[model samples]
Target: MNAEIIGVGSELLLGQIANTNAQYLSKQLAEIGINVYYHTVVGDNATRLKETIHTAQKRADLIIFTGGLGPTKDDLTKETISAVLDKPLVTDEEALQSIESYFKKVNRVMTPNNKKQALVMSGSTILHNNYGMAPGMAIKVSGIEYLLFPGPPKELYPMFENYAKDYLLSKLEIKERIESRVLRFFGIGESQLETEIEDLLEKQSNPTIAPLAGDGEVTLRLTAKHADSKQAKKLIDDVETEILQKVGPYFYGYNQTSLPEELMKHLINEEKTIASAESLTGGLFSERLTSISGAGAVLKGSIVCYHNDVKQHTLGVLNETLNNHGAISVQCAKEMAEQIRIKCCSDIGISFTGVAGPKVQEGKEVGTVFVGIAIEGKETVVHHLQLSGSRQAIRQRSVYYGCHYLLKQLKERD
Candidate 1:
């Protein structure tokens, strides 16, 4: 089914709040073989929303709305949609009881206006919102289906995943289901990667290949439509295998798996431990590594050797090398990685030393980065990167590259 998403809130228009609901819903709908054609953001104006609804119905088979389901005067999404569909807003007793019980449990009084949140569309499938009081609704009017969800991402995400997706899938009359896989890559530009896979994309038919570039990385989304998911998956896997045959060296992970996540998994699988020595990145590698749960299993510790003195004293870098290399060379990176591994007594050590700046440092131009990795039985390896961005962006990208470097080496040894 071709669908359009409408985000209804003045706050979204004013940039006070982001419309993350559309992103999540689009991904879910795509997985279910629905094609999202348009993303519409409308303020809480009845006339404008009605116009949007009319436009969406004209172009799409399904319309999904997020936001404006709260207990407030400005929440006009349901009011407008009900008017457009000529449907009544009836109180869902189950939702009302849940809201009332929540207020009672918290020892707070429920104002009459709060009941507005429990009012669901008449003759619609009510979506249970276990995470919040607002009930989502799905109804059809004049052959165009509407799925109304709450604005809060926490409430909207689960409601749609558990209830709305199944409801739509059951009603959708399609001969095939679309299956997609996202293959992530590092150390390869989108243009170069696309050039390598140009032939596959040129002759693509049953499965299509699309490339996206973001944050100094590349991603290829492979999508296929087939009657059997198992057969569709095989086709997708075969296509992926063919692509990998050409560019697998740059491939890092799959959908929703990032450099940090994959490194954590490998570390856990290898029963290895790691530590970080930071200079330009200033503990960003450590912070990201520790953010993953069970990271303590693989993460030993880290040292933020930002200053020359800290690098000399904490990470045991030679003063002479710093005086010559200025802490931005491959030699310095290797020493930092080796020192951190020895000091922390871990199986692996990683280091990020760079000049992330608006101006050059120590005769070294900005965006000069060196990521070092030291494994127990392998020689220390240092990878050089010349990146360009803000200081924070450079640091974040350096961290990803650091993980990518380590993962690459680990894969080589494996």
Candidate 2:
């Protein structure tokens, strides 16, 4: 079934708060094979909300409303929807008792206006809110379904997961399950990755392939639908295998897993320890590694050798090599990686040295990066990249590249 989510709040339009409720509802609806085509955000005004409801009713089979279910004067979602659908508002006795008991437990006198929280449309399914005072409601009018939820995430999340999900599922005539898997890739641009799997995207029907780019990474979301969950998953797997045959080398992890998380997993699983020597990135690589749980067992330490003096004195980079080729060169990176590994007595050592700048450094243009990796009993590898972006972007992308290269090395060993 097709759906539309209407968020009722002025704070969303004014940028005071995000409309996270729409995002959550869209994902939940997608899992039940419901396609959400539009998300509409309206202020607490009754006229605008009624207009939005009219528009949603014309195009969508299911309309979900969030927010404006409170005790204050501005809370008008149920009243507006009742006017549009010609449904009278009635008080749910059990819900009224729950709200009254809550105020009694808190040792506060309950006001008469608070009774409005328990008011529901005349013929609707009451979704009791376990975490808050207002109860959510679901009703059907003129072959269209309407579900209302609270604005606060703490209350809305549980209400939808426990009650609203099953209510919608029961309304579906054909019970088709939808499954989606996101394949994450670094070191490849979105356009390039799309080109590599263009054929798969074109021929997709049961399982669809969509590419999305964010934070210097590309992800392909594979969604499949079937009555059998295992069959749906197999459809996605077959498409994934076909796509990966062309671009598997760049694929790092699946669905919500990041490069740092994947790297930490490999390190801890293989009983490997790593150390980092930073120059331009200023210990960002090490910081990313240590942010993951169980990092203490896998990360030895890091040396932020920003200046040439620190590289020579602390990391023991050869003064002659710095004098001849400079710190941004491959020679300095290789030496820094090897020396940090020796100093920390780690199984692997990685180094980030580059010109992430607004100005040229040592006659080199900005975004000239050199990453080095030295593994015990393996030949040291250094990568030279001429990147383009702001200083912060360059630095962040450099850290991602470091993780990518290290993952590649670990995969090769495996």
Using lDDT, give the best candidate's number: 2
Q: Write the per-residue lDDT of candidate 2 for residues 128-239, one digit (tens) a residue.
A: 8999999999998889999999999999999999999999999999888999999999989999999999888889898999899989999999999999999999999999
lDDT (CA) for every model shown? 0.91, 0.94
In order of listing, the candidates' clash counts read 0, 0
Error of 2 at 360 (Å): 0.5
- How accurate locally is residue 367 in candidate 1, as Cα lDDT from 0 to 100? 95
List of clashing residue pairs for candidate 1: none
Worst 10 residues of 1 by lDDT: 169-178
TM-score of each: 0.90, 0.97
**lDDT by residue for model 1 (1-414), tens:** 789999999999999988888888888887778889999999989999999999998999899999999999999899889988889889999999999999999999999999999998799999999999989999988788899999989899889889998899898788467799999999999899989999998999878898999887999999988878888888899999999999999998899888999999999999999999999988888888888998989999999999989999878999988988779999999999999999999999899898999889877889999999888888889999999889999999999888888888888888
Candidate 1 deviant stretches above 4 angstroms:
88-107, 118-122, 128-131, 161-163
Q: List the lowest-lDDT window of 10 residues for candidate 2.
A: 283-292
Residue 73 Cα positional deviation in candidate 1, in Å, after optimal superposition? 1.7
lDDT, model 2, position 172: 96
